[model samples]
Target: MTFACGKRLFALIMSPFYFFQSRRRRLKRQKWRKRLRRALFPFLLSLPPTVWGNVNDFALIEGVRIQPPAAAVLSPGTSQPNHPSPIHPLPPLELTAGRVLLQRYGCTTCHQFGKSTPAPTPGPALDAIAHKVSPTWLAAWLEDPFTYLPASRMPRVVLTPTERREIAAFLLGLSPGWRLPSRPDLPPDPYRGSDLFDALRCQQCHRVGGEGGLRGPALDRLGTKTSRRWLYAFLKAPHIAQPGTPSHSFHLVDQDALDLCEFLVRRAPSGAELPDDFTFSEQDTILAHRGLRIAIERGCFQCHAVRSLRGPSLPMPAAASTADSWLDHHRATGETILQFHFLPTARLAMHRALQDTTSIPNPVALPSDFWKLPIPPQGSTPEAYSPENRDLAPEACASCHVRQWEEWRNSRHARSLSPGLLGQLVDEENPGFIQHCLTCHAPLSEQYRTVTDGDFTPDHGITCAGCHVRAHRYFGPAKPDRRLTASRFTGGQHGDAVRTPAFRQSEFCAPCHQSDLAGLAFDGKLLQNTHGEWAASPHSAREETCQSCHMPDGQHFMTGIHDQVTVSRALDLEIDWKLSPETRHLRATVRIHNRGAGHHVPTYVTPAIFVKVALGDERGGVIDGTLQTRIVQRRIQLFENRELFDTRIPAGGAWLFEFASQLPAHAQLLTVVVEVDPDHFYRSFFEQYPSDSVQSASLIQQAHAQILDSPYILFVRTITLE
Candidate 1:
């Protein structure tokens, strides 16, 4: 028994060694067979008549003998035959070639078809896109690529139709069959549907849900709220109808109209919805004082009339609504009716109405005791207030120009009459001068002619009839129909009724702006001659209108030459610095030159210029600093917004300065910064409208330095600092 057990143990111990030996022998035999086959196969294939081949044509080296090809080898199609089938299939070759083409074209640079590695995504991925796109789509896309994406960065690939088909087949094979979500296919006829919607008077304030007016919900995303069939049946027409009320009204239409119902369906998450009925309120009403001011300040009258307090009453509402269509229709038709009638007070009244309803809170408050404030009355109301009969008070016609009224509510002009800027210029010690400047600056209607200590209001700035007066004879841009007509009213406020295109003419502005500099009774004394200065300029001599450069496209978005865009282009301040031991100072020399503008070097459009200097430690904390400036146009009134000044910088001009500061004791690095004013000196302050002519003048300008081996060594940087 002991001998048998020992035998079993011995066998178990040798089994592993035998297994390893067997594997090694098998590997060795495979390697030998491979080598032997390579060596003998060619010789065996060529063994047709090697022994008898011509001995003179063969050569012998050492113990190996060789024979010429003609004597030893078999010819093609003779002994060894060619195979009938190809070694590899064609599909794999085509796929490999297509992939190579994709790489060569750089398609993978921005797009990742199905990459395993993560990379920054430059555009949307096309993973499994084959399931979504049809084969025909791929062909058409390759043919005319631009039709798919107007802003495509993809360059056109010159692939043959066959290659495109192969690629398309490969992509389509990714998913055996993919189906579109179950939704009824709808025709794309949005324009026709829009016309039908309008014809049906559906837009009479009712929105479809999401595709409709802002006043109501546009119904395009209605699937979450209602079912498709319900919508379809509703369109077919509901039996019960409500009058005046929206739900009671019939919303159903014919089969063709029901086609739009498909667009109403959509996918949604749990409990998704639009604003409920409880959210609608007067707050939604937009009272744009900007629009109103454009009408009044630009002189909407002379060619147009409204329901006036004086003269013939024209058609206009007592108050204005914020509805877009209402304003549009009024503007479109108002001019036609104004030519034959006069409406003056309507504009003023409308202005009052807008002030009460607008939501954008006014920062400046109107005085509660306006009647008690010391106010100066006008010499005479413009003739628009004069009635054919003398017994009635002259009615201000501004009461009817609702659009202009709303705009004035938000304008700085509305606050002009407040006892603020111009009023402060009035020497409280001398009330006579206050009354004197009041005539042109804050002219009241003939009906409200009186000077007192208790009747002040915001009606002091440039008012109606100031621009609409007869001499200006203003007309807005010509309508599509170019027929000209004369106003029917007799001459009074709006100058003599005349058939002229004065609105389009520049001379209309000369009256107020070009007023005689020396004798003008404005600002309690002659104010600086701005209009006179402009008139004397070459720009005026060349017949350039103020609106040409100041108001591009006649927009009120006032901008100035010193704005960031203009400044960046005009002045490039290349700053250089060096540390001088003798002076113990870090000196910075700024080389500023105007590059692409036509104005002066430093024209004064606004009042101030500031230069700031700072000495800082390498850690970026300031050690010492100070600022300097020249206030060119100082405020004449105490109440001016942000210290009013009129400063302008000429085009194509440069202003340069040098700053020096002591270096910190342990400074390792230094930084320099030169930035322009944040207010855009000229733009944000003075003009009612300014253009974006300056761009480089951002609020912050900075530069940095690193300490090298030597403290004095430096690198000069040339960039737009401010």
Candidate 2:
């Protein structure tokens, strides 16, 4: 070049050429990367779970040591049984790196917003998780990602145990579902609690407005008693709120529960000032110690965790050996035993453990007959009958009241007394005989000191005081505006008396009617299936409860199948007939339906009803010796797993019977009858196990008389067959 000047100019030109070569190289590299992605994208998108032999198993390749199956080498995001999986899973090496690059470079955002076309569902969308899973389950799953539903697609995230619980609580809030009633919108309304409490029978355990039972803490002041948030949580999940408390899934509707919360909150006294009568036990050492002793004797500490009372700790049941891990795992020891009993396999494990040691605590209370209620120590009445409600004689109320007294006396609620029931009270030979007979029958026998053993407060039968008095307080279903004060004669007793609608609800009778005993269920059918029947009945859907029918027009007669009038009013029977001359046969078809009753026709194991048909001659001589009997009852054979045939006509269901007989020339009469024997079987049951003393023989005679005289023959028809 000139040479230096020409060389400089050429150099400048060459610099641009070099820059262009470098740019071309970069473009070529990017194109190759894109081509690689196009090839790998489809394969990775398939989420192929390539199963292969252990990666550690080496293979000899031609002149090269082929590494452990490279595909099996998990990516950073891949899940391992021992380790938590990452936020989102991806394949290993180039595939994962390429996808991350594509995401980082904003290549896949065109269609799916971020990541890939088929994007992951955002965590917020899982608000519907409440409809899908239980709150406890969700919490447990989130606590340790693998704990519940290990196959769940939810990736392991950084959250503490408390955070998981809080998230679960929020998620568990009821949301609108396909079915509206099940997932009702809960608008806060405190007023609804007053009626809802009674309707739901919350007072059966919980005392509210000083008119309910003392089984649960008094709820006269919900606002000052506990925080609103805690109350809501407790109502939603009672067991979770206070662990080891005897809580149940009431299956309350969301709207109803919120309404109840509203009422209970408003129940609090104004300005948080306790009532003038409110007494403090902390100042009185004797009262405080008495309460402590009572709690211990009642076994309150068995389930509840009490932090106070630093007395010597009770010894815990020693743990069983885990040599049989399966047995140990499934035994369902301690608190979970009640739940375990419902599960078939767990029951077997628990039963085996029970042979050695009782692992399951029997917490059942309802139908207390199953628990073999303990008899009070010999010749001891807890108190000489209290004067006002002495013996709770049902007639005693007349001494005080003018209106309800006479109504109650005339009602079946008053006429339920009998001598045979009194005999069983003292009879100690068979504890089962002293079951819930007097609890509902003569519910106040303890107050009257009227029974023998008095184990189960076995009085002759029910009286007024039982339902009215609790903790020396009188309660009843008085109207909202009604004012109640101390009983005049029984001073200090029932002072500032309270009334609640729960007194008239079905829950009042649930003690004797609804059996919580697991033993009572045979093949998932209750022996005494009345409550179950009503629960499944359409009447429940219509809001027709037990009290609605039993106490119609404010009458407490409780007239059922035993009452002919009640029976006659409940059924609409129809009969169709056909006579065949060639076959010389007479056939009558009868259809019986539970058109009116809220439950089965006869809703107890004790009653055995029969629909019978017979053929007779006009001269009263048997023409065709045919007697067809259809038993309509559900009975469980005691101490046996087997059950007697249940032929009960379910509510709103029908029972059809066809009677066929050869019509003889002399056969001029056909008779069809539906016979009911209510107390016959029950009397016979008691007669089999009579008491030792004077009461036994009299009770036996009563039993015999019941079978003979108590037979109710309904719909007796005599027709002359042509």
Candidate 3:
């Protein structure tokens, strides 16, 4: 046959196959389009009418309208302008929503957005991807994370089928020679796993079938997406799979892990299978290389750690740049809106995710003149009274309540404006930032330097007046008799005390202790979750509160982890020792229980407890190398916005530390020391503030030194076994 005829014959033969591929691609696109519309329709409908006005003037993508730069995005409590101007319009909802979306998705991790330093990327490190998940699951996850986990913060990057397979190959190929452990022959008991789950209090952080906490991913259909083998491995040691995962290591036995895997896997719908069309070959170096390039080009490295590629840090957004400018820049480059085919869906998803995760309420509005105390009520202020009585000061209150003042003086509330905080504020030019810190540190309006009130005492830090006096009237918890009245003599001095039950409620303290900043959260948990922690505990149901223990007997001492006695009372330690005389070996098992604390023991990330076991000589010291230590704390890398691990014992939970070692000669004693560092995280944070880097260097140095001295031995027990 002629060459031309051969070419024609080949083309005819491949036409049907090409047509089938084209049809499949078109159907896939249609499916996603419908899904996006379904997800976004209700969100768009709920927006204010103003947002939909002049829809023809805005960009239309897949039947949804994107608001123009002139359109205003009104949050709750925001009102529309009475008379809108054509030349200078209100800032678009797009800009506001866009900035929020950027932060929520961790865009600032690689790209500069504003004056604030970029937070660490919140993505889990992928070093052990091979062991954590099957290649099929990884490909499906990379293709569209929302399919498997709707609440995931990861944005779907548009990629072809080949690209998806390549990316999966690249990630799975990270540890080329890695292999999964052999599965046990015996079947696991799901019933036992269910009991173990409850015992571990997994519901405290994770959800199942839409009925648990939002701190971790929902496990409703986990079995369908992952294999029992992978689940068992993950349950055994979550950190080994994903180093920065917020999931705690429960140190489960092999049988327990197997049973938990069985229980979780049983949750999948009966006939469901792992989602993927093609198998990925980790040995395909060419495909992996291509995938790495695609990952880098698509900015996957920005949020995720791609071992083969290192993304460069972009320049910070200009100091003068506003949110509007930032959005405009991204829009101009088509990076934020046009690059992603489902931008509308992503935006709507972001709104939903935030609503689900954010636990804190909106900021309460204060009176316009809230900074100044109201004019002393009609006849309450007497000219016969001295300045001490009229002035809004802790010392004035101390004149009558001497004992409470003495306790408050030595409390953390008194030292709220610690050198560490003050040092950082010294160089902070933003008034909003300063106010945010002082909101909890020195809560009184008069304590603000800008208040211009004569009673401004910034150094007093959470004075008695801050909590008890407002609008020149005294307020406190209702007396046991429920009487709102004060004595006839004292009533004239500070006005009739306004007795309210709110003063005794946990919600009263939530404002400062619980935070909901989307940018600061890890695994959907707030940075400071003490109030949230208490709310989830049995204490909240029983009406026990932060004040119950911290301020026992209405004492002003606000005792916390810093108080050695308080900490010792919260934790119960038990140690078991086994010595092998023939082998000259010692094995120690120590367990620490959070029995008293209403919240997690060492609740916040600031404190860490070290459980150490070491072999000691007759002199009580000279053993060379037989020490083992386990830390109990929430370890987080703040700058990277990643949580390495959370070993903090939850209320009523316990942690086990096992140590085994061959004893050296002359090791006559075994010592176990449990040390508590109240300022563990702060020590590292403050150490970064060098003299040349900040204006308050001396203060920072002093703060570091103080933290170094804050650690104290919580428990020490020596077992002599010569």
* Deviation of model 1 at 612, angstroms: 2.2
Measured against the true structure, the TM-scores of the candidates, in listed sequence, are: 0.34, 0.42, 0.46
Q: What is residue 86's positional error in candidate 1, in angstroms?
A: 98
Misplaced by over 4 Å in model 3 are 1-386, 450-459, 485-492, 517-519, 690-695
- Candidate ranking under TM-score, highest first, comes to 3, 2, 1
By TM-score, the better pick of 1 and 2 is 2
lDDT of 3: 0.60
> In model 3, what are the clashing residue pairs, if there are any?
120-639, 120-640
lDDT, candidate 1, 362-465, per-residue tens = 11211211111112232332222223111111124332333344444444344344432332322222232233334344544331233344344434355444
lDDT of 3 by residue, 447-554 (tens): 656432223343477777767765444556665543422111111123234455566777566545654322135566655677768877888888998888888777
Candidate achieving higher lDDT, 1 or 2: 2
lDDT for every model? 0.34, 0.47, 0.60
lDDT minimum window of 10 residues, candidate 2: 1-10
